[model samples]
Target: MTKTERQKMQAGEWYCCLDSELSALRHQARVAVHQHNTAPPDPAEILSPPLAALFAGHGENCLIEAPFHCAYGLNISLGSSVYLNAGCTILDTAPVTIGDGTMLGPNVQIYCAQHHKDRALRAQGLEIAYPVTLGSDVWIGGGAIILPGVTIGDGAIVGAGAVVTRSVAAGQTVAGNPARPRNGWSGQ
Candidate 1:
């Protein structure tokens, strides 16, 4: 039997994003996000119920500022004490796991979905998704962009405006586009 588009996407295989089931999921997520974003400045009223219900997993003490965005909220998980500042966007076509105590600065973007390099295939809406994982205590600076399949190790710091295309070692400090280790400081 052929797998559904969502199944293919979850398996990290190429799939059609225009599938009806996926569209419905996106719509549901948008509704939940709208409510969360527009809710009054009360954590108990917003995060505890509405925002928490949208995610696959949400740990205690997690705080996400308003204006957060995600394609499918169900594919994202947050650990305890995680804080996401304003303008954070997660394109969670695949699972996105953020470990405990992780902090994301304003305008941070994490994308799990990628289109085919072939323009023809991309034009047809063929896309692949890979999971993104951030280890405990990691800090992502403002405007950082983490691409598909990237794993940021524990306690690592991603400098502002970095474009992380590959995995970062634990405790490493990475900066610049296509992010590289800063000042020869290894994770040590």
Candidate 2:
């Protein structure tokens, strides 16, 4: 008869972030992330057992450098050969899909949660989530911020320090804040 906060969140509907269930989930993610960030590196594993278990799915050779953080790790799915450099943060309130061969440079941030515009609603932690998808072979440069509901197509290049507010088409090269397609630029 009634949908849970988690269900609403996954459905891209407005939901309260301060819900007890969501709080508990975030706590669990924090613990795993702390361990992942602080633990000594082991050549044997790309991700620690506890940390790897948090993801919905992760493929072969997926590497996420230390100091990576996610609001809800279970909402992330990484394809084969996906590499995320250090200082990456993903606010995965909704599902985040990284396709095969995608590489994210240091300090890249992906945000899926959009808080309510109303001050009262924001104070209450009300937000809606939208999935962010990166198609195969995409390259996101350092310090780039991919906002909610953006889908980056295959082979696209996102230049450093770009704030991508819109979706990028396949094979496009975009740079600068509010990321627009770069004209006459060959992939050098």
Candidate 3:
């Protein structure tokens, strides 16, 4: 598992201090714009164009607002018809995958890596990567934070300002500080 993922991580981090990575990322987005079909295409403000291109393989309809931050964007896979509102932050030290038609409200955060609590490991300045996946049709409200390795299944809705530390299954609606299942969505 580590072998397959390590290369990508290395490839992505390689550009953290290199200009070539930025240039390459931008070039890819331009090519994608010409090669694929994108709606309301800006091609101008694709934030972190290099990083976006590296991670955005075939993921379309992504609305990434300015001032976004990430260690690596290559690990993210966003499906079509999705919107990421303002001030969205993705720690994406690992991989963050958002499914089709998913909606991310303002100030939403999806994280994929966390440092060890123990000082010994934390002192090393190393991180452990965890993958985050949002299933199709999921809706995450504003100011919410999805922690590492958490999965939100299809059609699940997370309330505003919730802190998700566990996984939520399909059709569940959850809220509160730690985000417990509030019961199934009240809709037909």
Candidate 4:
């Protein structure tokens, strides 16, 4: 039996993004996102339920500022007290898990999907996805872009405007493009 595109995507295998079911899911997510983004700014009254309904799992204390964007909200989960600032975007072609007390700065982008390295394959809309995991107490600075398959450890800090292409060690502070660890005296 052949696996469906959604199955392949969820399993982190190569899949076609142009599949009908996936397209429909994206459309549904977009509609939900639009509602959340445009709704009046009343955290207790307007935002929480819709945002909670959009994600696969989220804590009660999770707070996300308006203008959030995601390809598939069902693949994203958030732990307790997770805070996402304005203009955060998550391309959740695969699972994206943000742990407790994690904070994402404004305009932060997390991507779990990538196109084929081969031009022809990419042209054919073949893509591969991998999960992104941010552990507890992680802080992602403004405009940081986290690439596919990156796992940021607990208490790690990603500097502003950095591009994280690799996993960060626990308590490490990484800065700059392609995010390298800072040479500091203490991990704290």
- In lDDT terms, which candidate is top? 2
Cα displacement (angstroms), candidate 3, residue 20, comes to: 15
Judged by TM-score, which candidate is best? 2
- Which pairs of residues collide in model 2? none
Model 3 lDDT at residue 66: 47
Candidate 2 per-residue C-alpha lDDT over 1-188 given as tens digits, one digit per residue, 9 for 90 to 100: 89899999988899999999999999999999998998888898776776689999998988889999999899999999999999999999999999999999999999999999999999998999999999999999999999999999999999999999999999999988889999776534
Higher TM-score: candidate 1 or 3?
A: 1
lDDT of each: 0.91, 0.93, 0.70, 0.91
Candidate 3 versus truth, CA RMSD in Å, comes to 6.7
lDDT of 1 at 173: 98
Tell me the spans in candidate 2 whose CA falls farther than 4 Å from its real position.
186-188
For residue 172, what is the lDDT in candidate 3? 91
lDDT of 1 by residue, 125-174 (tens): 89999999999999999999999999999999999889999999998999
> What TM-scores do the predictions have?
0.95, 0.97, 0.72, 0.95
Looking at model 4, report the run of 10 residues with the lowest lDDT sum.
42-51
Q: Candidate 4, TM-score vs. the true structure?
A: 0.95
Model 4 lDDT tens row, 1-188: 99999999988899999999999999988988888888888747523666688889987688888899999899999998999999999999999999999999999999999999999999988999999999999999999999999999999999998999999999999988889999772323
Location of the lowest summed lDDT over 10 successive residues in candidate 2? 179-188
Relative to the unseen true structure, what is the C-alpha lDDT of residue 89 in candidate 2, on a scale of 0 to 100? 98
Model 3: runs farther than 4 Å from truth?
1-51, 184-188
